[model samples]
Target: MKPSIEYLQDAIEKLGVENDSKAAAALKISKQAICSYRSGERIMDDFTCIMVAKTLGIDGMEVIAAAQMEREKNEERREIWADFRKKFGVKAGIAGLAAALTLGSLAPSKANASNLELGAISCLESPVKLYIMSNLAWGGFSSKQQKCW
Candidate 1:
């Protein structure tokens, strides 16, 4: 399971700051909040998770799930959040793989024909999967698409 502190640490590191105070300033939070997060006294809120995700260039849902899991007291609830994290992680990995394959196919080489086909398949498959999952989860496509884009 990905910890919320790991996300906080990654955000600070990505900002190239050596101290918590500077990280707090960059993150728009008090140093005490940073300390609380680092010390595991507090879990990041959804907004803060989104901020961290933006800083780390990853999906906000993954960070939000991690934070939610960290904050949950019930084992069952925590497991649900963990499941969300796993799903989001898989989605991010697939998106990354698809992007890599797509970019690789862009390279000038006849040998990349098969890769281009695979990339195209992945590109189409990812959205279809996402659409199906979103429909099942939310019961409609309109809201999710609006929020995601």
Candidate 2:
């Protein structure tokens, strides 16, 4: 079972939300992530937990412990990118990507629904619609249902 959205909601509340910017401010992450975390669709990561705790002036270890009991929680998700690269070779435009990250974490699948979305169109074969999607280090982008040709 995962922690309830209320857990994050409570954490947010502890920080004393500014109301109007709740959603926008939280957009420091993806809307899907916020919704998923808040709705219990996914668990909060350690970075988020720590942020919440720090904003609330509480202890991170304590929050993580409580969060863990209700969810299959883990620490930061930065490791997911490295793991993805190890599992699947980076196709294109990934040369300086890992270097651009400030938090040492890669952003989610960036190129989508555009020319770059499919990488090199000619690189793909005819008679098959091809699109290149990066694995979002965390839960957004919904790559779970996709099957590449």
Candidate 3:
């Protein structure tokens, strides 16, 4: 991998520069410019790269290559993320909506009535009640009837 600005900063500190201000002073640049370079917010020019490398006693090409690698990696990651969103965004949304609908259907609706009894006794017509009544003729001829029971 190419050397990042952070790597260069570390090299500078190893060479006895205390902080960014000191490093910038060594390179004859503003502290803000050094901060921007360190943060990768601004690109370092070839001349500046060489100056920084010379100050830190390192090869300038190494510093430039590292910065270029970082920039390229950042661009590649952005492209990959954009492609992923384009490929899956609509499908993911539709899947989420379908899951919500299925779960909603599985849950009970407040508007529908339930057959289970509450505290008070209530009469509700049922097929089992009709069948029981038809099967049982409770009278003197109950035993003589066919075995509907």
Candidate 4:
């Protein structure tokens, strides 16, 4: 509905695409991308629309809802995935922005990445977290006594 340039910009920044090149690189788009979108010369695809909507925390159905069955089936899955990946996205965004600004790794998927399909977080992945869990489980550790005592 509201496809203003300012709205597009806000959406772009919120999605961690704070600049033209970064936006183009991340979305595999081109310099004409934002211009086209803003000038009504081109239409953004479904995925970008969803991405923008999710990042901006806005209603995508303002145009057209994906579909009833797909919506119902994917809603829960999306929520769970969002919660888990939020932190990763934030960290990746920060590092990614630095890299992008420095003309380093523009795209994250190109460098020896694979799909692990993990359902849970690993311990070594976050030591501080697992350390707290370990302490809670073992009650306490006495380095001076050099024993569980």
State the local distance difference test value for candidate 3.
Answer: 0.62
TM-score of each: 0.70, 0.37, 0.41, 0.33
Q: Cα deviation of 131 in candidate 3 (Å)? A: 99
Between which residue pairs do clashes occur in model 2?
5-38
In terms of lDDT, the best-performing candidate is 1
lDDT to native, each model: 0.82, 0.53, 0.62, 0.53
Ranking by TM-score: 1, 3, 2, 4
How do the residues 1-149 of candidate 2 rate in per-residue lDDT, one tens digit apiece? 21335546775666576652474265355666776776566777777777666665655654464455455334344344334334333432253464565323322254453434343443344567779875665654555555441
**The 10-residue segment with the lowest total lDDT in model 1:** 127-136
Q: Clash pairs of candidate 1?
A: none
Per-residue accuracy of model 1 over 46-134 as CA lDDT, tens digit each: 88888888999887888888888988999999888888888878888999999998887656466655545545444555645334343
lDDT, model 1: 0.82
- Give the clash count for each candidate: 0, 1, 2, 0
Q: lDDT, candidate 4, residue 35?
A: 70
